[model samples]
Target chain A: MTRIAEKFVEEFYNSFTSEVLTAADPAEVVDRYYAAEAVQIADGIEIDRDKLIAHLRPVRKNLVSWRYEVHEAVREQEQLAARFTIHAQLRKGRMLSTEVHLFAEFAPDGRLRRATQLTRDVTPQTPQDVTPQTTEAAPQ
Target chain B: MTSRELRVLGMTCAHCVNFVTEELEHLPGATAVTVDLPTGTVTITSDQDLGLPQLQAAIEEAGYDLAD
Candidate 1:
């Protein structure tokens, strides 16, 4: 259970990052990982599938590159929990880094049924060496 | 009954509150569980004072960390 959950967390972010940044149809990418009825609340705001798709459009357009560093992941039955950091590089040399704590419930088919996340910006030590941040707008 | 309050990490939603409440309620002597989601504070009422290990175990079983 532990290993499976950890691997799932890693793969989910890796796939989402790669596909959303490069795929011509990013909505299809969202569909592959999240259920049609999936709801995500980040920092108390809620977004359903259509809103998520709308959110991904600008991300796909502006994101240059991104990566995840998963610190921990665990699962009990269908409940999954993870703590990770996202480093994103955007257009025009802007960067942002954020640490995230996420909890999610998965459907029987392994797609996300619902998720809630809390994120905090990771301040870079110096202005000239700023790190990347997640492009997901909900955390801002 | 005695009441204990503690902070838990990685709890970001109502579902997390449910999971923690359910697990803590299973502990021996526990009577009630209340969670403050925004602050990640959980208050548990029980017949006797709960030990740190016992509380830690329940929180961990719910897939969260008991804040130090």
Candidate 2:
């Protein structure tokens, strides 16, 4: 990967936690990464700048501790795909964790024009996950 | 009214699970969401009436498909 691309990835991880997720005013962070007409899609919904702030507002308030780790990244032409994991320690001992894949399309000036984010929870299972055996078969 | 089992499509990873879980939580009175990755199924427990159309819309917003 080019140095610029690697730098972008490094900045992305920091800016997310520092500027986007933690800031009281997210508009500043938004401006740094997204273009004037940029759109962020989560799931399939289009979340414009203002809406993005709204969506994350609750999370910011409720989050106690969180960690973001980049698993992989690929840069192809003007598009960059970043795969990462987010672990959130929520209130009341509830933990929310997910793997995220983000695809961003950048303008010639290196400003993000559009981005799509996908996420899923992390769940590991063991033998306990299997259904318990019954002592007797069901009566026909 | 108590629980719902949704067969969702395009859920390949844990991110898919998170997106589906978020959709379920948007529903009124949703208490919990259980995502079985191996089966691509989501089980939602709620006290409010969970509508199919609403579930479809939520999933779609997150770029997913709910099997009708």
Candidate 3:
């Protein structure tokens, strides 16, 4: 439905870390937003909802700040796709910034049933052999 | 929406693009982030003027420089 659009995705991202990570009972946030059968895929790793919750249980201990800013967002029927950036800072001065493309499938009840995220580290270009940028035209 | 483009250096991939994009997204009223890799340009959509110092700081945080 129309509810599965940009606004819904924004609400989810906004609530995720701020609500879930900081909460004494993080499971409450997960249960509110994710379906019981939800699956999450990221960085070649996949986990069910329970596992995901368990993994994030320690998120707040090392966290300074984390924010997700939605970039391009699109939706069709029950599916939502977005390209975004995540800025994360840890307590010991470990900082991470990355680009993420995420797609989610919503359950009939409007909670996310499945989600897949693709992330790439924000690193300077690696050194590589390159072709010349310009073709030197011989005098005709 | 209207956009402002910053000619930049040190970005070469989608991850690089997102670096600048995300930095600008942290600015107040910033709405969207777009990067044109071939041109070495990043465009920001925002309702308020993200002053040069702000943009410069963001770019610096990403380990790059904003061209004048």
Give interface RMSD for all predictions.
Answer: 15.3, 9.1, 11.8
By TM-score rank, best first, the candidates go 1, 2, 3
Model 1 lDDT, residue B19, Cα: 58
| Model number with the top TM-score | 1
Maximum-DockQ candidate: 2
Residue pairs in clash, model 1 = A96-A132, A96-A133, A97-A132, A97-A133
A38-106 per-residue lDDT for model 2 (tens digits): 887765656676765554544444445555556778889789888866665543334565677899888
Q: List-wise, what DockQ does each model earn?
A: 0.01, 0.09, 0.02
Candidate 1, CAPRI quality class derived from DockQ = incorrect
lDDT of 1 by residue, A1-140 (tens): 66666767866777777767766887887887889999999879677988777666545544566667788899897898999877666543455667889999988887888999987767375533333334331100
TM-score of structure candidate 2: 0.55
Using all chains and alpha carbons, the TM-scores for the candidates as numbered come to 0.59, 0.55, 0.55
Residue-wise C-alpha lDDT for candidate 1, range B2-62, written one tens digit per residue: 9999998766434355557767887899999999878889999999889989999988766
Candidate 3, A19-78: lDDT as tens digits? 765567878878877889898876546778776665553354444566565677888867
Error of 1 at A38 (Å): 0.3
In candidate 3, the residue pairs with backbone N, CA or C atoms under 3 Å apart (3 or more residues apart, or in different chains) clash, namely none
TM-score of 3: 0.55
DockQ ranking, high to low: 2, 3, 1
lDDT of 2 at A102: 90
